[model samples]
Target: AQEVHCLAHGLAHCAMFCAISGNAPEHPVISTKSGHLFEQSVVEKYIESTGKCPVTGEPLEAADLLPVKVASTVKPRPLAATSIPGMLSLFQTEWDALMLETHSLKQQLETVRQELGHALYNHDAACRVIARLIKERDDARQALAEAQPSAAVAAAAVAAASAPPTSKGGEPAAKRAKAAAPAVESSAGELTPEIIASFEATSKTLSKGRKKRQPPADQTSAEALAAFGEVASEAVLPAGPVCVDVHASEPLAAAGGADGSVILFDCAKGAVGAKLAGHSKRVNAVRLHPSKPLALTCSQDKSARIWNTDGTQLHVLSHSGDVTGVTLHATGDYCVTSCSDKSWSLFDIDRGSCVLRVPDGSGGYTCAGFHPDGLILGTGVDSVVRIWDVKSQQNVASFEGHTGTVTCLAFSENGYYLATGSADTTVKMWDLRKLKNFHTIEPGAAVGGLAFDNSGLFLAVGSADTSVYDTKTWGTIKSFASGAAVSGVGFGRSAATLAATSADGILKLYGSSS
Candidate 1:
């Protein structure tokens, strides 16, 4: 009975444990033998009181409480191993996200670096440009500073050199001497002052004795000559021919005869030496070469003839229209002629051909001449004088001042001055160096001819009134009325005799001490 009770108690306790743990009956709890006996005895006592089974509600019995042996089978939960993989996948995803962010940051950093590099390059270039500019500015400043003193010193030196020397009294010596000189001559001559005074009272009568008288109307040449009282014999003669050692010295006297012949007189001999007679019409102009034996004569027949001193015709230049004037080169190798056709042509003696033709597009040409250097040629067309370069064959300058036709021109020996005579009764002196007009001498009548002395100290101008001018001050030294309206004037080679031609077919000569 105790064994039955003990079995019942063990069965009850096992059933209770299994029920609390929710274990299967086949997986029941096992204990030691002593503990099982204690449990069985407890269970038997309880069962007798209740008379019921604790499990299954069958009946209280020791046989029914027998221990059943079951196999130990326990399966793991589904997908238990997959938890670790899922966790690993989550970690891998997080790592990928972090890597992506890092890459994006790196890309941004690279972009920023590239931008910075570009900006740095631009800044460097700007800095270099600025540096170059600064350096250039500094160099310019240094050059200016270095040049300032030299410029100032040079200017000051020029001023000093140009300043006139001062005297102790602050007056020029020349001025003082001029003021002290006597205005009247001393009475020391053999002719007493009283005699001189008496002579001066009849001076008008004496002057009238030399006056030209008009010939009887319709008088013949013989009658006129007889009445004129040997006027040709009374004419003054130059000392002799002054042969200048210089080559091609220009003739002092160039005259055109009524017979259409051109004659060049030796300025020193006062004698006719050469006659040029190539023109079929009246010769209007004649000029000797500045430094050669060649002569150029323009005629009303619309042509100019180049001739040798021996009267040999070298060339007969025909123009499209009437030739008015002709001038020879200093070397006598070239010549220029102005025509009423409003054109001028340059002739080369060596080539025997017209090298250039210039049209006076504005007006008709009246006169022309070569400059002293022979490189510049000047042409007077109406009231304007045009200068041209022969080598370049170009017009260089034009001078406009004359109111009427410019008829005559003379260049100074030094090549620094030029003189022109116009039909406006004015003579102008031009400074070639300065390219400016220097002086104007109004002779009160149409100026027909002009000539400068070899020394360039005096100028002879022929008009209705023949006059001599002091070149230094442009002052008229003397003026003598010609018997007839003068057509030409020239200085003799000695610079002492002045010869003039008039419309009356008379050639008059005047002597001067100064």
Candidate 2:
């Protein structure tokens, strides 16, 4: 059933109110030209009272009323204000709320923007701080790098200036002072601080000779030539002794006579141990084994004789031509001999056989030396020192700085450096690590023999005036006038006894007369 409401009138037809209540068929209706419905009794009452229709106010009688016709069979439920007008009012209220929320969100967004800007500012400041710190660190490092060298140089200069005028026993006081002078112009200014330090350290250390071996207590003088004793050669060597060696480990010493004789001497007592006679010609070179009781001698007789320390002959090595020089390997298992035939031969001692023979194609080989390791050989030719790798049978390195025939070659104990002496009166120090000559010294005479001490600290070069130099600085540590041209120079195993063989037949011994 449809709910009826009185909109304009209190009592109306049976039909639903057209304005207030929607049209429904289940409601009884009474309508006329006004298109409204009312109850039949209400119309009759209205006609009896006012004699007109309620809506239209037209004159109407009860008998003239007609019922409105509807097609729907069931009555519709009553509805509240759910129409377009009501929806429009609700939409207006929702639109106002949405506007308020948008305004609040805009305010929050602005606040977030301000906070983000502050955070960005802080990040930028932190970045700047980090950049500044990095720059400062780099600057400090650069400053330190620049200051260390200057400080080191200044300290070195001060120390040198404060040093005493007299040297302990090496270079002359004036020469040392001149060499150590910081302002003495040279190539040092072109080198780095580290390189300069290296050069300076070498100079300082070399200027001070071995302080380890104190002179004998009985000795009172630092004389240059205090001959301990002399060993006389047999039969009066006509051409003088050509080569000499001293066994520092023992009190034994040997000298090769010009008449192809080797004279052994007991250095401590200054007595003759034995006299070896084998070759028919002059002995050119002789070397005693470092630890063994064996000695090797090469002669112009085209033979090299290996002798026991007791002067007994062990083996004989025959060469194709006059043997000029011979040196044994540190191990005593091998030896190298240089001959006038422009060839150098490597011999196995125990096997008594030649292992390899390398010919100097350009010039006659004058001297041969074996490295400490016995893996390489050095041969001196005209103006060049050729280094051969024994295993590969190939020349590994060649040094050429000498203007005359290369006469002598000596390897340092470490086997990393080589000292080559030439007849041009120059000795060049070659560093094998770089395969180049590092330094050169003029000995003022034809270099006959070169020897590096067992410790590799001192290098003795035999010339007109025998000169001993510190290996590191290549500085002349001491100079001894041999009275005659020095033919050979060597230090004993202990490096305390220095022997120099000159044209004079007498074997000169230099040491403290303990």
Candidate 3:
């Protein structure tokens, strides 16, 4: 055969190198079927001869001869590096680099997935917040609608009561009672615009009148205080007296006892006027009707009784638990009672129906009272005092400082301050306008009762010993020794006599001798 040498002095085709095995230099192109590469001219000539592959001896055609692309640049390699071990080492290095790149791509994909999940969680939270806000708005609107009618009727009654005597002297008692039962659904006790205006007007007028008619100095002087002594004692009951209230215009007093008996007394004669009994447990509080001849009493029997002084029971306000406190409105037709069941109820006395039931957020209420104008309510729970707008049934103000249970609460006569005594042996005076505690005094013992005289100038605290403080100076003006814990204290209708009932079943009377 003629000496036809391989092109470029090559001994054999170098698929991965520049004319040398294991010498990868540039632009590598792999075969699609055999996973190998060859020089373009070498493959073409091999296919033309015998029409078969040199290595596999397979039938090959010219079209099967593909080009193996490479870069123009090349590097020389050592002849010893053409061994199979060196080639294997080079392949392993390339495989490692490819695996590292794939791992980096996988990490990036996982991070993207985590970011997407966090975005979805935030979106869900925002949606829930929006839904909650919308629900609250709807509930407030419904409450306002339910409260308007009753507020209107209550406003009219207050206006009539506070206005100067008209030709008719105001709405008839029957007509006022009828208005108390609103035609709307029973979800009452909301403050409407009309009611707010009416209450404000009445308060302004009352304030001016009070300023002009301040009580005389000699009314509660120490010289007058010395005249107080033990008066006639009523028949001893099965249990000690717990609460007492005097008729605002009569010489009569009503006392509720632990025996659940509401006893009436004639202050002038020092004798029992009537004994009204109905409750099956201890009586906690009693209040004389402002304008009517009725007496309201709350008891541990889980009910409040409204009775005439003549021993005639009028209405029994039943409750789910022990009634702890009761207060009648200035109109004498509406009453409010607080219970140990975590609720307080507003009632229509003449209609004998419940107008509203309000639940306290902190367990049960210990005591409750109405503002002199009847527009606001004060309640004692735990160690704090909460003031509510009566019409709206919303807590508008809260006063805190007591370290123990707020056992007793009494609003000042002028409606400017509230006196609350706690079991911590401290009494605090709260200014309604400022919504802050104006003064705090520590008595020698735990306070059992609190009372403000009709002048709003004197505050009495019943503790180990009953002591009176002048509101202007906030000083102890006088002290009385009852020898026992005084549980109830109050002034007569005319503010002429001070009376206190001791836990030993004795009622002591104090007055200035003429």
Best by TM-score: 3
Report the lDDT tens digits of candidate 2 across residue range 1-514. 1322232243333346433234433434455445566655555667799988777888877666555444455545335345877777777888999999999999999999999999999999999999999999986764553333224334434555576665568544221112122121111112235433543454334323322334344322223323333332222244674677777467677888777888886667756778888989888898888778888899999999888888789999988898988987654666888898877776777766776676655567788887655555777767777766544334555566678888788988655678888888888887655456778889888887788766767788899867778766677767777766777777765466677777665566666555
lDDT of 3 at 189: 57
Model 2 residue runs over 4 Å out of place are: 1-236
Give lDDT per model, in order.
0.59, 0.67, 0.71
Q: lDDT tens string, model 1, 1-514?
A: 4665565555655533443234444434322232222234445555577765544344555543445344455756446345988767777988999999999999999999999999999999999999999999986765554333223323433444455666669844320101111111221113335433443344334223313333234322222211221112112212211111111334345567545666656654546666666676666677666556666778788888877878888888888887877776655566778888767777776556776666645667777776554555667867766665544334454566778888788776445667888988888777654445778888888877777765556678888867777667777777767766667676544354566776665556565322
Candidate 1 off by > 4 Å: 1-252, 264-274, 290-292, 512-514
Models, CA RMSD each: 40.7, 33.0, 22.5
Ordered by TM-score, highest first, the candidates read 3, 2, 1
The top-ranked prediction according to lDDT is 3
List clashing residue pairs in candidate 3.
Answer: 190-391, 191-391, 191-392
For all predicted structures, in order, the TM-scores are 0.49, 0.55, 0.60
Candidate 3 C-alpha lDDT tens digits along 190-235: 4347645665666556644654575765456544554566555554
Kindly report which residue stretches of model 3 are placed more than 4 angstroms away from their true locations once superposed.
1-205, 216-223
Position 9, candidate 2: lDDT: 40
**Residue pairs with clashing backbones, model 2:** 13-38, 13-39, 14-28, 14-38, 14-39, 15-28
